[model samples]
Target: MGVHGTVAAGFEGVREEFSAFLTDEEHAPGAQLVVHQGGERVVDLWSEGVGGESLLGVFSSTKGAAYLVTALLVQDGFLDLDRTVASYWPDFAAEGKGGVTLRELLAHRAGVIGLDAGFTAEELADDRAIAARLAGQRPFWQPGRFFGYHAFVIGALVGEVVFRATGRTLQECYEERIRAPYGLDLWLGLPQSQEPRFLSTLPMLPTPEQAAEIEAAAASPYSLGGIAFNEHAPGNGELYDFPNSRAVRAGGQASAGGLGSARGLAGMYAAAAFGLNGRAPLLKPDTAAEFARIHSEGTDLVGGMPKAFGLGFQSYGAHFPVLGAGAFGHSGASGSLALADPRQGFAYAYTRRRYAFPGGAAPENTRLLGAVVRALT
Candidate 1:
């Protein structure tokens, strides 16, 4: 159960248990977890075929990074959450979405969840193409009424606003402002050079009974929008493997398909908590406060579960009860999670090459995290 590397400060057992649990076959094949507290790194650990320099697809956890980018734009007076999205991108008004505000979009309430028209993975790489499709798409529900968990669309919309404000894609803005300045290893649009370091995603394991239930649920109107009965049902899984998925990757959709190391992910959150390792703050104190404040708190339309969403990051109570409101962050499809408690300047980040079984978090993962929290308290 001994972690190979070092634990920064204030946390020791957390790092040890994290490494041990990751070694389990059911958890991350290769993963990293980094934690910081009191302006110092307390637990920086990695194992299970992952190393200090490894990078993994962080899934929805990418939302935190996207949220940071938008927050910066707001702080600089380039974007306003209260303003209509069309004010920035006129073409967006074409689809009866002229009334949507930046806040609704960020909070996953804008309702751009599903694209009626199909897109290839390659199409996602072309920013103009992706934005055009997104802009022309209609909302699944009325804007600002409730949350539907835009899943992938949140990133595209947020990216567009960031695009309009800076005259650069979200990828470019992140590199220029956030990643490069902090030396973060995260990438919205990964370069080809790093492909070797890319860990292949692990497959999900469902027992025959579990798979049957999942299939049934997917077919149910409550799950697949009744599309499960149609021959024309969209296959979202295909979009992940195909090279054409770059369009999805390139769009910087904050909800899914972002890449980074656990260290980099935790580093960004740690900056918000501890204020950037002796550098200028990543966000003003008030801005950081806004980032953690819940924009929408209720059951999600898609997941049909209670969720607490902030400006972009998912709040703690939505899933992990151990994560207090002060501990705000996001989790990927399976086990990937990135969070920081600004109150304590404690950040925890974990990423893996493999996808987790669908249902809840890996028990070993939670058990490890629980031990960490218990130790910290």
Candidate 2:
């Protein structure tokens, strides 16, 4: 297999950069890259071992879609961000979290990161099950005072609100409003018919040095970081295997069970920010700005590292020097990244069927993204 796809006239360098990155990889990354300059796709490329249309597990990048759904509802006045989560789902207040606003919850401030006892794989795959269990779980930190990743359950919590408010599953709303309408390849709840294009996500192939670094920073299975990722759960599978399960794909565990290609992702962000296919943008300018504004910054309590978060998206300006102040997106365990840079008038996405060396947005994005941005200018 070799690099295959198209690059618009000005983005030839992006194709060269993608080829160069795959050539240097010891393992075939099976990667795809897509860039949209406003609503017009400027680059579309894929490397060996994966087709341009293959839908691979996007891990946390799924949150970008989930957040977009939430933003739309808020924009339409179907949901209120300032209202307490308890107002929508009363059970959410059982653990003295009655006051946690929907805004705080989206920013990962509700503090019900994971179940105190942990979830079985089946429960973890079902957002309703996850939400029910978390309703009474005590917050690891005071609900509004501290923030953590809520790596596996934020979607369930937020989705519960959508369900209670609108009487529809978050997945249903997404499919009806975004995926089907746009003919996107991304699936929140992948149907049986679309399973042929699905590809299981590959685990990270870490270097000896990277493995040592992981071991050195290892936390207890019951620690906040571990629980947040469901590492403490009995019989919980590896993080990389979450989307490999048919149950997970069917249920569309909103936090991380999304399956998509680079085209789907880039198209999504482009639709939100720039009106894809000549249609109106999914989100109005005010909604996009509100979601992209920084809501939380400083060290992440669960990951124990510096991070920045907006409504439900990763704020890039503080940490990613290449992006402007309002750029927002999410990175996944498979080294996939997707986002819209409103100020720069572009949307970009990269996906991998093979996990990257260290994980969390392959480092090559620096060069690849730099190439795309430069081409735009």
Candidate 3:
């Protein structure tokens, strides 16, 4: 490929290793992976195939953006985690969910996993309609019974909370308060003009030979692309590819769909690791602490593993070590991952077109990041 940027301060050897990782043809399509140490840009690297301006789909990594939205509302004193969802949106209590707390929803403990089968893609386009549908819908499991990853519903649930607390939708509020202020290129509902720039996510439908080849590889939900799996099948599902997808996209749903550039994503977390404008914190210290707190522990409904989750982001463990306990970020469908490690004062975002294991190509990426972190530390 052509010339990519270099690492800045504390991350010297990291950039060199990242450069070697980028050269892997299997890891290509392209990506931008950046790491910040002590609130300073240390490793800033972007490969050529993944241009700086290209907005590749970051899959579920969008959840990190969603977490930022909820955290901001909490910071502004508009939304309280301990408060019930019904406090902001009255209809949220229509069903047995009247008692579901914002924190429960944030931590993916909300029993409302999927919407009613009657729910349609058209309804997802209208925030009001979807919110109403969700408010009156019954829980997939008993509220607080246990945590199951609410894949698609997590976005609408969190976004609606932000909306009820603030007059603006998650997308609008995020842009004005977060992305715009930081000059980040991340977006939830990408506009039509920019849609062309978005690299549509390709399902990791392994070829017959590949599928059989990897049958014994592992049985991870993410490995099977479970949560990472897209249900764009013909049904009364949400309109994922609608021309007006931007409206729903504006909601900043963590799961279904969101868009942005790798660098832009790196920068957002970069701002989190560092401060935005001097003294202006993206999340209050307490809130940031909570952002990485694990609220639930059980077999993730989607990932089908013993996983833990904070308010919105996933942490490091058997599944991902690149994201340590102190780190908070999310992985998207395909092979996109983003996170912030306060312990190391580091943030990294990587995006690529290739969709490999749903459990993520983390093992491989971890090898790459381990080298990076070793250098930074």
Candidate 4:
């Protein structure tokens, strides 16, 4: 299987790393990678089982898009970071959450990770439904005392705030202000016309040893990790199946329901940090820095792992040493990762059709990103 697409002259090493990655995999994990240096797309590549135009379920990498929209609204003064969330959506004030500020909510500190009564499949597919139920739920921890990864519901939570303030859904704002203007291939609410390009996400094919490790590390459905992912729900399907549903892609639940190609993901971030075409960057340096600054760092209460966050985006510098200090982005459960490194003057996106073993950002990103950084230097 040959790698497809072009790399600028000096970036051939990235293509070599990508091909090596495909060769090392036991199964062909249809993958796409894109990188932009300043305003120019320096790398655009895809491997077997997928095309350069193919769209895959990007899972939580979708969060980066949502966070970018929120950051823009804040930069425009339509939203306030320090103001209590209850000020925008009064219902969120119920159950001792009145004092939870927008900043705290974005940092995963409000503690209402999920409902004690888990969400139905339909509710999980709709951001409005998820927000409505969570509005009255009690926090899992004292609000502002601790932070947890609101894995499945943060997008809906932030979307609710966007709706209350602007009388528009975050998806709507994204399409109108970001996607359409930039002509980006990424879609919050994927339309019928673009359906043909989407490929269903495949489950992870782990080796026997890897399977045993996953089984051993599995937590109870009622555990914090389980609840955060809505695994406690009676009829809940696997996480990878979330974006496989047409309804999920159509609704664009905001948290993990995004569908896009690597080009779309990379382009969006590039437009945000370095501008695209002839336009000015979407975020001012001050606004971008504020949202990208580390707001939370340490063991996450829900996942019980060392995690870092800046507003809603994952602060990637700690996880990827090659990235600059304020680098920000989000990774999907299917091993997709996308972000813009303002300090490094580049935006990178990698998407996979099959879930990577050990999940999160995918181990291959470390080597692949290293190759990209070296080429840039």
Query: Largest lDDT belongs to which candidate?
Result: 4
Error of 3 at 311 (Å): 0.9
In terms of TM-score, which candidate is stronger, 1 or 3? Answer: 1
Pairs in steric clash, model 4: none
Can you write out model 4's per-residue Cα lDDT over 1-377, one digit (the tens) per residue? 68999999999999999998787454386899999998899999999999999989999999988999999999999999999999999999999999999999999999988989799999999999999999999999999888999999999999999999999999999999999999998889999999999999998888899999999999999998899999898999988899999999999989999999999999999999999999999999998899999898999999999999999999998779999989989999898899999998999999999887777899989999999999999
Could you give candidate 3's per-residue lDDT for residues 258-302 as a string of tens digits? 778766777788776567545355766677778788788768765
lDDT of 2 by residue, 1-377 (tens): 48899998988888988888686453385899999999998898998888898989998899998999999999999999999999999999996999999999999988999988899999999999999999999999998898889999999999999999999999999999998899888888889998999988777777789899888888999999989988888887888888999999999889999999999999999999999887999999999999999898888999999889999999876667888889989999888999999999999999988776566788888888889888989
CA lDDT of every candidate: 0.69, 0.90, 0.67, 0.93
What are the runs in model 4 whose C-alpha is more than 4 Å off?
Answer: 24-27
CA error at residue 371 for candidate 2, angstroms: 0.7
Per-residue lDDT of 278 in model 3? 54
Deviation (Å) of 250 in candidate 1: 6.8
**Candidate 3 local Cα displacement, residue 241, angstroms:** 7.5
For residues 201-265, what per-residue lDDT tens digits would candidate 1 score against the true structure? Answer: 66666668868987876645325233211113355343224222544444444556677887888
Clashes of 4: 0
Order of models, best TM-score first: 4, 2, 1, 3
TM-score of candidate 3 against the unseen true structure: 0.84
